[model samples]
Target: MEKMKPTLTVIMPAYNELKNLRGAFISATGALKIAGISDYEIIIITNTKRDGSHDGTPYVAEQIVKEDSRVRHIHNNSYVGLGFKFRQGIGDARKSFITWVPGDNENIEESVAGIFRHIGEADMITSYTSNTQVRKWKRRFVSRCFTEFCNLLFGLRLKYYNGICIYPTKLLQKVPTKSDNFAYMAEIIIYLVKSGVRYKEVPMEIKPTAISSSFKLKSVFEALGTIALLFWNIHFKRTRIKIGSIN
Candidate 1:
């Protein structure tokens, strides 16, 4: 007569993160155990450049896979975008719920456990950072602008779009997200929200780290372009066909 706990697949994308991958994996495992999630798998997607540069991460990931049967490694010979890695994880996931934890170790065990504790309360568990002061002023400003712009463009008032969000595997697989950049997270959230999927926003605390690679000028431009394309496709190019309800 008790409700069953949902199984989870934790997608961890590592690109030249040999220093942080092991710690991230430890944190993920600890968090899952803290949340009392007995059924889970961690997929570590490691990437190396075509020229054989950045080779260390794949080796570490493979070692982790060998050490833990619950961990799987998906190696990319060439450097693909993060969005592509995310999609690959989604395709490989075999669980009731799916969420991503970056290999940079920015999300610690307690924060992840906080997010996991709220599972099954809604169709999706969307997280926002409670402490933005942990980041530099420029990064904080940019994040605020991005979130506001997304809200204005999509007419949704969500707290954050790029944080670790938990989605049902089946529901996420149906969304045709087209961004090969960081904007893909926003794209997925927008599509699901527009389709009337219920979501709950939770607050998470992030650890301070060096400037992220995604903060580069090129990535900013790429995200802008992707958002423009998403806007066009969502508003003008196609009709908003409703996916089946999660409820």
Candidate 2:
């Protein structure tokens, strides 16, 4: 007998997380085992050094995959944004379902498995924090402000825009995105909702990681611009299509 194909693909992108990759890989594998789902694959993407120079992360990821048959690695020669790495993983995935487990291990292990349970009921599954407060004051303040601003501007009611999301890979492959920064995640969600795809939300625990990716002021303006473009495209183009009733 031969092994069956995987039902899910886990995309874990590691930039310079060689030290954390081992733990992240193990935690992901453990969650898969606890979920009782054997048919899945993990893609560890080590794009490049943050400064676009050579680094050890890619080599470390290569070694990890060599040790575990379930794991695999991709090392892009150039440094791309986090969203770009995700797009690469999405293109490389071979499973029906896909979810991102950030290299920093922000998602709790138990909650990782629970995401699979929601796939049966929705096309896209996202998460929010269970606790009332975020531990880091700056992160909490920025997160709240971003979510509120986006919801108000886009006419959505989502609690957290940058949290974990589990997507039907097929649908994701078909949708087009215009963002290459952190806003890429938001672009996908907004498209899904406006396009009438069924989505669900759940509460999950977010653990603090050893590293914090800088939230730059320039990225903020870029995201805001992406949102404006999406708003115009969705509302303006959608109204025209409805009037024409072009299926």
Candidate 3:
């Protein structure tokens, strides 16, 4: 039994994902239908290569967009940060609920189904990988550290922040930061939770993507810097002046 109650706008960030696009699209749509979501639009951000390589992504995006009215393409000829590309889609979203679905098949369609089921119950619905055994030891260690760090700092018992999430459009409009990197989503969650916004955690299984994870060392450092900046700005520097002056 499926009901068309809540609408959703799925923002998919695409790079050179020509190989994984078809399966990803199929799985997403199928899961949405299974979850009883009625009205939804999938926005594909077709980002070009920085070196002007022939990846056929824009052409693929064009073809896919033309075939399905529910699927739209945001073509970008130049390179940009993942956050900016996501923001481009986010800015163009036209639904009550919003979520970013990766173009690669790194996630299973079943996860999207879970989010849709719990979306209307809270302002934010987040998904974390229930089975960490599928990941490599190094990756698993890093993920655990990051999750613990977020919880300790924000006083939230959230398991993960880098995975799938569904957010209310109104709360996002009130969010303050617009980071253009891996730390952007974490900052979004932190900002909203600190403001007393409600959220729900949905555990789901993780799937391997067509391509292996390649987060560079530089990006990791940058993400850490963002975490520090956000922690200080929100908790210390910003909180100190709120409870009268400390002269």
The model with the greatest TM-score is 1
lDDT of 1 by residue, 1-247 (tens): 9989989999999988989999999999999999999899999998777575894998899899999999999998887888999999999999989999999998878888999999899989999999888888878887888899999998999999999999989889988886878888998998888778889999999898877877788988998998888888878876353667542
lDDT of 3 at 73: 89
Model 1 sits at a Cα RMSD from the real structure of 1.4
TM-score of each: 0.96, 0.88, 0.89
Model 2 residue 223 CA deviation in Å: 1.8
Query: By lDDT, who's the top model here?
Result: 1
Give the 10-residue window scoring lowest on summed lDDT in candidate 3.
Answer: 238-247
- Candidate 3 displacement at residue 17 in angstroms: 1.1
Of candidates 2 and 1, the better by lDDT: 1
Let me know the TM-score candidate 1 reaches against the reference structure: 0.96
| lDDT of model number 3 | 0.77
Q: What is the alpha-carbon lDDT for the whole of candidate 1?
A: 0.89
* Candidate with more favorable, higher lDDT: 1 or 3: 1
Q: Please, what are the lDDT tens digits per residue for candidate 3 over residues 1-247? A: 8644778899888778888776678878888988988799999887767786747877777788888899998887787667777778778888988888887766778777877789777768888888888877777777788889989987888889887888877656556666767777888888777766678888888775322433556667777887888898888866321111111
